[model samples]
Target: MSEEIGRVGGPKNVREALLISSETADRNRHEIYEFGPFRLEPAERKLSRGDEVVTLTPKVFDMLVMLVRHSGHLLEKDDLIRSLWPDSFVEEGNLSNNIFVLRKALGNDREYIETVPRRGYRFVGAVRQLPPTGRNAISGVLEGQIRDVPSRQTRRGWKILFAAAAALLLFAAVFILRRFRGENSASSPNSPHLAVEQRLTSNPSDVPVRAAAISADGKYLAYADPTGLYLSQISSGETRRWSLPKDFVVFPRSWYPDGAHLLVVRDPKHPLDSSLPNPSLYKLSILGGEPQKIMSNAWGGSVSPDGSRIAYLSHTNAGDLWIMDSDGANARKVVAGPDPNKGGAGQDLIWRVVWSPTGQHLAYIQAHYRNAPDPVEPISSLRIVDPDGGGASVVLEDARLGPVALWWGREDRILFSYREDPANAQRNYGVYSIRIDGRTGKAIGPPQAVTRAEGFIEGMNGTPDGKRLVLWRLRVPAQVFISDYDPGTRQWKEPRRLVLDANENLAWVWTADSKAVFFVSNRNGTWKLFKQAIDETSPEVLVEGPSISDPRLSADGTQVLYLSSSNPDDASFPAEVMSKPIAGGTPRVVIQGKGIGNFQCAMAPSTLCLFSRDGGDYVFRVFDLEHGAGRELLKLQHQVWSENGSWSLSSDGSKLAIFLDQHRIRFFSIATGAAQDVTVKDWPLQNGDWGANSQTVFMPSHSPAGVPVILEVDQTGKAKVVLQGKPNADFGWMIQSPDSRHAVLGEYIPTDNNAWILNDF
Candidate 1:
């Protein structure tokens, strides 16, 4: 009976054989697989629905592939864990999180994956082998059926085939033509234009335009660079520099509604110092005159639409949002941030407040503390509150790395600038807008992109009419440099560029042998570890993956330690400390936690490494790698804006030198946990590292003329100038060799920025 229905060597046999051969070829090639409407390409490490690609994290993608590979079979939890995290210890919660994210990515077809209570997971969906070239498997069956038809049916089959092919061709042609026309209509030179962009400032010196604001009348622009404040007439292109008190530095924040006066933040001392006392707000007129003080201890301020009230942020232990009368009276805190006594863990800052045009509401940005658990949820957010501080709510959460300028536009829309990926914020920033649902104080619509500029957008402000936007574009290139220090002459030789790359190359440390240096760079889109010999011109890749930071070499010259993360764009992703052999090998997980910062190990006789973790406070821990154990050594009070390299390990690993708040340094004994303050009269140390013999620490200082110089501070709080940086250069992140003969420094080349106006944007 089976032979009568279908005989061997007939058309059906040929088709079956062809399909079997195709399946064999697919398995050999390890190409795409099909389950329902989804196609999984194992070779490409990608999944797709028809022609659209799906995005997934590295681990999540791997888990999905494993499930599909063992379809119809239950995968034990232990088995799955062994397969996914083969080299490291991962908690069960992490596996559950991946499954949850995978289910969400699968959308409506997530039911294909089933769970057995307290057992494991099973992929029950029917999956088929697909051709390596992505051809439809059903099409092959159809072709076989047509060919197997009797002689009399051949003409009809051919006609049907021709008609179907013609239809598909016609549809494809129409789609292509429509797409071409749509693209051309939007950007073609012949298209009717609605707006034009104009360049306002042509700075020949390449000095960055630091802060900028547009006047209410939209006729003038006020900007500050390294030199001083400058006023420019937008229409006539005339510019004039304003004269101010000598040595006084100020940044332009906002303008008065009348357009003739501006609100600025002035710092008589070091402008970059976060703990500067009473950073006062002043009103400077467009015409030359002595500035009038508006309020002390305030920074970013915005005038109300009617100019009756001023909303400003006060710089204190707890950053507070305050509102006062136009003349700086009746100041009251409207939004209170984290309390100083509480360590300001998550609720640290309120940034860049702006009053709405109607004066009924005020909007501002809030910064997320770095030590969060969700990895991506706490970068920054947008909030809207009633001017009286009632009914305050977050309008947008997890808005990527901000301090982004906000402008309330027509139709209740709030426009701001943000980078799509916070990990690459240095290169990408675009303007986006979302409308607010007024009654609920929530975002109404999805964020729509206004412009994706090529360069970085530093600051943005819109005109009163909301027809133009003034913004600064910046491009900075940083390189690594090495200098020779002569202990005999007590001087440093001119620094030579060490690692030459267009991308940022930041120096981390010198090898224990002092023959090569290791650094972290983003030249390949993700920050990775690279090493270069002292005499080499180019660097060789040492470790490549998601993102790496704070590379450190072990004191015994046997291991290299660094902090790494799978999702570098998200701060909530806990950074794990990993170590490998100095000569190179598979990296082994050493420490796993959230907010792991820079680390340092003892140079010679000690096998101890000291690292810091940011929770509510900066906690320092000592890890004994040889014993495979760690213990908390000390904890420092958290400062809102403390530098990452604020602590260093002594050479013998017996003590740690920590820079504390108020320009103070503390020497803590590692053995007894005793602490003593080392007083340096008036020097504000920005960056420092321990010198040879552990008796003195090398700290970078600036001369009165602002030239970079290095000062060696001894245990007795005495310091003297050891090396001075070249004129017109900035030195940061100093790393000294144990022998004290060579030093590696981070030299920041000034980035050129230009101001441009986007008309009708």
Candidate 2:
């Protein structure tokens, strides 16, 4: 899994790469360094070990001086790349080659150059700075040491240029360190009662903090807002906006061990689900510069404690855990997933892959759906594994434990967010901790609750010192809405919000008379079926459950339909189709199975309801309303690592359109036993439904970056954009009422997220 900026072959040695980097160094070359037996002269661009002179290329000479200058501190691989080839894009192999040559030139002193695994090379031998000589009292460094192309001929201006370069290293270095540590003072030791909570940002509801991370020293905060990316001084509250490229979508994930750079992710449309468009992982300086690309299609990149490697999840690979050198080289799979060779049964997700405090193990959540498309949440376990992929063990396993967020602090203690109440309050998610015995990698005691909140803590990050923590909280709730629609003209207007509350409400099936709407609402703390009339305000509870979802109507429109997982406390409960008369009564089990997916029904005159199961393939069967099961109608090969396809049933029960591939739809005729292919030409297709006329299909889609649009496509594959949606919101499901005058759409309203600091962790 080694990701390189460029994989092309490089010159055999540094001198053969056609790189000349010492223009500024040639003028400001005043510093001389000595380490072990090797002595380096910047003014003369020379190196020697005792009586023997070391032959070095220009770039190799530059690299040696850099390592000696920052002897004890880390020089990130990206930093070295920019310094070595500031104006050009070169394969990472060139840098590796330079180091290899330099190490060989240094001879028997194997201890001189220490490779930091994933990070970069470090000069481990004791280094001393020699007195300034040659009439030059000051030296400077730009991206390590000022660079210029190599020169085969001698410079006539060497004497004058060497003394002309002004001072920068001593003064700029001190000023930068002070500014980075703004009013940063050591706080009293961390204690439970002394825990202090502070709000770092005061943004409005619409303008939210996208993502954030604290500096290694706990003095600076880097965050992204609607306006732009910014860095804020914690103690002084002074914030400055980073000059990012227009329309850049970057979120700071964590800081490097050096405390001068941050690793960030770009175009992360869906952070939790890694099956979407590719996202980028890169590094950028807090002092401001162009981002240096590291890896593509990577997410949740959390650096190890030593900053030598990064643990990230692959996007298209669906939660395959991987670790790569901090330099984006020598990547290895840390955890074996669904064999990439087979890659098709179903994907088990891995997320929040953070390193343990000691850097020996990685803590993450393993989410698996025994029934991959069960509609219910997946079973999640808080687990850890050694960096070498050994000593794997689970710390916490429960039906209530989900994948909201996770973190590791001091003393082998892991803090995570879990659902506290079964069906009482989803918003009451609380933070809990399970202590692991460091030696055995197993839980030491029962889990303990750290804190409870009225809103969900979407994410968590801790300072390097382990004395502070930062949380990103989300409180936005979902609601059902209706809009007047004229499908012929493709116009939507006079929107009306229904069942308004602080809980989530998802639009589903309508009633027999089309006068009321039947939907799923979390108003009572758990998802249950509710029926509300178009003219009424209050909703009447129809199906009370420990939990239920994917509500629909019977073929005859006489019974309400839904799926219930049977047991609330069991993670392996199989979902069963439960039905009750439209007027309401005791629910009866109609069908029982696992891995049930999207299903739909037609009205009275047509008794066609289709049910599907996703596993080895997409199996669609003609289901009876009154009976338990029916015969299989069709099955299609499931595309691995791709979004599951969606289908819509025509009101007349004559046509069924299934959407799965990027551009084609399979339309099946129930009466003729004939199927035709309809292709969408506007853009890659997304979730949609059968149009009222059965001659058109309406699709709600968003761009790779999340700009919403509605498209109307016809049988011939011709299409046109009907309308565009709001900028900040995303669509869930769209359905039209039986009467066709109103349409119901599910929209996840934007949330106001801010960074909160907890001191004395």
Candidate 3:
């Protein structure tokens, strides 16, 4: 109902309201009723969701009012079609699709409009009806009326109403909190943490060793520490702390889909500690129980959809056909035996394991064969296997395709990420999908590419309905966006910016309306609550937002919530946790931990807040930023020394990708308590970019003896030289362009003592 100013000014005055109503009165076809929380000037056609301007296609807005005015009646399919498309011939399906799309853009308030079975649609919510007031009540209000309005309510009555409103708000908060927890199914089988860190200066924080994972029920999240594990409650502010034995180093690897336990990799000594001893995987628990050893050879691990089994790649010498149930008593090899070509070695070097949504098959990575550590190893291919462990084969492989990501869905279909390089081999990766059991394990091509430039995919969690695919893309400095994955069309819609600001780090939640995005941003210098209309041509900022990151939208999209800092100005550190409205209003702080930097926050599928506590030690703590009850999952002895580690959470929140020191990277499984080094030997210099899918890392590598070239690495652990020319090329200073279409090569021209942008190779 709020009106947007063309530029910037105060609220709309009485004269303007009168002018608007009078102008629309002549064409008042059916007494058009337009009103919301504050006020709106329909005739001006300018709408505001608080202080931000909401841009909308003219038609989308028109459709909105038509439904609003008809507040409580069903508008049959044909009935509305006739009114809207009177002059044109359109199909019923088209009308239905348009209505559906419009609803998505309008956001959660669509509750006012109800879907009426096979009949049509109805607007059932209350409408703030505006009256003509013959004498113009707003502008032409008499002095007596103004006096009477205030006199009607005494100071005490006003106080009572304010108190009642506050109480009701509190009750509503409780209801919504319970609803989200209950609906998301505290035990839903998916929990992926979205990690966002901004490298503000020339020097970035040591690549963060942050780890994230979700409980089998999607409620609990386990994160890594240099020394231990931290268990956090996703919905309620709750947490439990776990410390690894002093002698045995532990790191989380995977979370059982069952949500009750975890699988961790425990090493008597660090595997990278001496770079000789092999790492092993062990199963851990969150409900407080003894850990059981799973595999001595397992590294990058994954749990099956049924939760009865596990899969992981053994050491290079061990066969890689994907050992299943590698945890339980019935554990055995699942995929076919290793490839015979390489002396009957492993069949795949599994990076990401996507269990079929319907629980039929699995898709994983098959690293390429290499005799030496040349930076030109291509991706082997994608391998699909059944749970029973036998019908396994390469589903996609080509000279151009590189192993990126593999995600399984209902019909044994696999959604993967790869790059298409016709020749030079500097192929940039993008999102794609394919059926595992198709004809030959050849290139069937991806349905849609998620990113154009070398963008990294942070989180890709499918919606409960399986219609929407939520993803996070990171460039430099950082930007958060949302894209709609429509399986029916097999096309990925262009991604829309979720958070308005581009320079800051952002994490968000999507409501029912694809456009109404609620996210947390550092636009205010510190993280804060911010909401915008994803559908609106121009989104309006709902609230100033709290200093929080990792925001999750309720499944229905009605609420925009997130964890807030326990305190805004502790001076010691960030606030604990808090939440507020996506539509912009007051915020409620939920958790207040002493000496905690509330700024450390990550949001997985579960709505819990994952934050870091940096002080005496680098601590990863999880709590329902809203309810304030959770514990620590793990802590690392090296956590304190590590500064800028980029932490990433797996979709299921079972695995965490921690990039410590731009060159050293590791993946810790929350389930296995195992931390495996993903760092490639001599991985160029420091600070480059995270390739598409997040798994593929792109960093400028110097060919010590040859030309200085930029190398690209895939999830398969294979690397390829992407660019080369000048010796000692400003590698660390090189940056990706805004459009990502071109990379800026910052070079200091010795002749002129000036820097030039290399537009030409």
In each prediction, how many residue pairs overlap at the backbone (N, C-alpha, C within less than 3 A)? Answer: 2, 8, 102
lDDT by residue for model 2 over 171-287, one digit each (tens)? 444432332222123522331222223467767666777778888788989888667788989887799998777767788888887888898888645342234546889898977
Question: Per-residue lDDT for 160-275 in model 1, tens only?
Answer: 99898777656644433333222333555443222223457766434678778889888998888878888888887778888898866788878888888888888645544444
Instruction: Assess each prediction's global lDDT (C-alpha) against the native.
Output: 0.70, 0.70, 0.46
Superposition error at 736 for model 2 (Å)? 1.4
- Residue-level lDDT of model 3, residues 1-761, one tens digit each, is 32211111111321222233334433443232433432333444554556755665655455455555444434566656665655677888876776777656556533345554345665554556555544343442233446555654576787899798777656644433333222234544443211111111111122222334544444555655433567766445365667455555565555666566777666533232224346777777665656677777666566665666676765544445455564445555665445534334322345555566555666676664321111123355677677677566766665344443444533535555555433322233455556443434343544444323333333233322233332323233344444444556634344344444443434323343333445444443344455555445344455443335445543223445454433222333344344555545576665665434322222234343455554444466666544564788666543322233335443334555555653566666666878777556644344344432334555555553424455666544566765554432233322222222323232211110100000000
Candidate with the greatest TM-score versus the true structure: 1
RMSD of each: 17.5, 22.7, 26.7
Residue range with the least summed lDDT across 10 consecutive positions in model 2? 1-10
In order of appearance, the predictions have TM-scores of 0.71, 0.70, 0.36
